[model samples]
Target: MNTEKFLELLVEELELENPLTLASNLKELEEWDSMTAMLLIGVVSNEFGKTLSAEDIKELTTVQSLVDKIGAQQFS
Candidate 1:
């Protein structure tokens, strides 16, 4: 998926009022709680058809990090 679409999914899943621009930090977002993190993990898995553990989600600090992980999965 394209970056914009990915960001849109993130924003929706996290229930953010503002759009996620490049500078947005995942940890700083108000909705970045455990539940949202789990939701993101599920969303990533569903969208990319890859399985990720909760540990994997905990390790991600930025949206770019998640994107890079998904991109790597495309090659694997």
Candidate 2:
């Protein structure tokens, strides 16, 4: 779960043409919606063995936050 791998997985999940940076805003993505949120929930749960609550999703505004949520340990 290095940062590069996580970013790749995220880009795939979001189906984004542009690469994602730490500053990328989740809400600003055209692909973002309830469906995307649900997809992310599964991604974190299944891939990282981490669960994301609805409240957690609501609080996340940027890609960096997701990295933080899943924890920097995954990268290290």
Q: Give per-residue CA lDDT, model 1, range 24-75, as digits (tens).
A: 7788888778888788878887888877787777777777777777774443
Clash number for each model? 0, 0
In candidate 2, what are the lDDT values of residues 1-76, reduced to their tens digit?
7888888998998687778888899989888899989999999998889999999999999889998998978885
**TM-score for all models, in order of appearance:** 0.82, 0.92
Q: How many backbone clashes can be found in candidate 1?
A: 0
User: Relative to the unseen true structure, what is the Cα RMSD of model 2?
Assistant: 1.0
* CA lDDT, every model vs. true structure: 0.77, 0.89
lDDT of 2: 0.89
Worst lDDT window (10 residues) for model 2? 13-22
Q: Which stretches of candidate 1 lie over 4 Å from their true place?
A: 72-76
